[model samples]
Target chain A: MSAAATPPASSEESTDASSPATGRIPGNRAIWVGILAELTEFTLMFLVYFFARVNHPQMFHEGPRRLSLLAGSANTLIMVSSSYLVARAVLAMRQDRPEGALRWLLAAFVVGAGYPVVKFLEVRWNLEQGLTGGGDVFQMSYYYLTFNHLVHTGWGLLGMAWVVVRTWMGAYDAKNHNGLVAFASYWHATDLVWLMIFPLFYVMP
Target chain B: MTALRKIDLAWALLVLFTLTGVFLGEFRQGGFWVVLVIALVTALKGRLVIDVFMELGEASPVLRRLVRGFGLLVPALILVTYLWGPLLARFNWLLE
Candidate 1:
């Protein structure tokens, strides 16, 4: 499913809404709906965190105190850079510059790869300190939220890899570049969710 | 070209500043306010990611509407649930 497999006609350049190509790609509505669904899921998780805090403030504090905000901040920067690179790739593709797009996608893939390594180290350090989620509500929430985020990050890395391979092979162009757009949206949404999660779980006191 | 480059530079600097703030604040004692500011900065960064990086600013009107609707609804839904559901649970009045 490489984007370059389908070359759009020259007439496809118009951004007019009345153009036949306007709604051809999977509508943005679906993406927004997915975002909303994930937001609802996150909200429920947050409500759980809030109720837990109300019931067990000491436990929440003890667990949160062990988190490394340094690693969290580093991961944030990495993901932000990755998003920027992906956006650049999309822009390059829109300008019909496949080589530039490929380079940017590769940059994004490299940054995406760094995230899981940092997350693995964080988890290992936490486990070394006897902070497994097997006991206590706070530990459970910690594992649940962070692990859920880790899973999404893993998927995001894989998606970026796919985009890199496709872009390298001239698989995407302006008209049929939904994969790039979709991947960027998914990756940014993951970051968006984390922007909230990091504060609520790791930073808030 | 200059305008686009400036926008990109501004976004990059904003992200760097936010990251630095978050890191410095994270290690400080009694850092709740600092973290809160970091969160606000983070949300601002998110908007940049969406508007500039994701090109939502140039998105079609229908697409924009969909994004705006979802954005507003998701937060509102959570807040309503948080506010009312807790009250109902405590009083057991809504079920009755």
Candidate 2:
């Protein structure tokens, strides 16, 4: 709920379309390397998804009806909120508000932790509904993609936990929070993946 | 606007777009246009996260474009696949 971070922007630029391109990387350049890798991994998986969907359109259409929309929606909100909180943490660091930044990161971790919990419950519910056969392309894609995402989220949570500790030690400040920024970049990238995944698996039908 | 307010607005829009996507998914069956709209919404959401939250708005043009390209390309791929999936499937042997 705290304010987020960034170099600075005008009201006009905030529209996203008109935002001035300043040629700045958020944290460190290395983070983008990781972010790009993450994107590549998902890109490959998405190709598989598109392939499966094309071959068996009916299964993809019927897949959503079988899964719980509530769970999917809940996970989407959770991922978005987590990304927002981490962004806030980065902003707090920019303002040289270490305590504030720490709080934001902590909040992010708490919220992000909900992802796996919701996922666990969702998986359990899916099993209870007898959706475990993985016989169809849709079901196979659903489990593989979501489960892969869950694994990535788990890595992100670990990173957040470490970043949270680093923030607490006053390791990052206004002029030198590249580590924090990098973490933010990775988390945002992960969040971006989930955004795409939600629609493909849950909402696209 | 303040940086905080800018991202807050972005976050708000992200949530709004997400809920709208879900609403559309819930009420309607799949179609070319519906899927296109959903893909566009998703691309927009990805752009917001990249430019705003990732603070790439003022960053290098190359980096920004690379990430933004992912945002646009994935949705475009989704659309193309949705439209020509069967034909594409015929080329599955290429993967083999």
Give the candidate number with the greatest DockQ: 2
lDDT of 1 by residue, A63-159 (tens): 6677777677777777777877877777777667889989888888888788888888987887897878896898899789878878888888887
Task: Write out the backbone clash pairs for model 1.
Answer: A3-A171, A3-A172, A4-A171, A4-A172
DockQ of 1: 0.27
Model 1 per-residue lDDT tens digits across residues B1-96: 332463477457657755655654466444445544554555566566555655554455554445444334333433443345445346434335
Instruction: Highest lDDT: give the candidate number.
Output: 2
Cand. 1 Cα-lDDT: 0.64
Error of 2 at A4 (Å): 24
Worst 10 residues of 2 chain A by lDDT: A1-10
| Fraction of the reference Cα-Cα interface contacts (below 8 Å) that each candidate reproduces | 0.17, 0.65
Q: List model 2 lDDT by residue over B40-80, tens digit each.
A: 99999999998888877667667777888878867898789
Q: What is the Cα-based lDDT of residue A35 in candidate 2? A: 87
Q: What is the TM-score of model 2 when looking only at chain B?
A: 0.89
DockQ (Cα-based) per candidate? 0.27, 0.50
Task: Give each model's clash number.
Answer: 4, 8
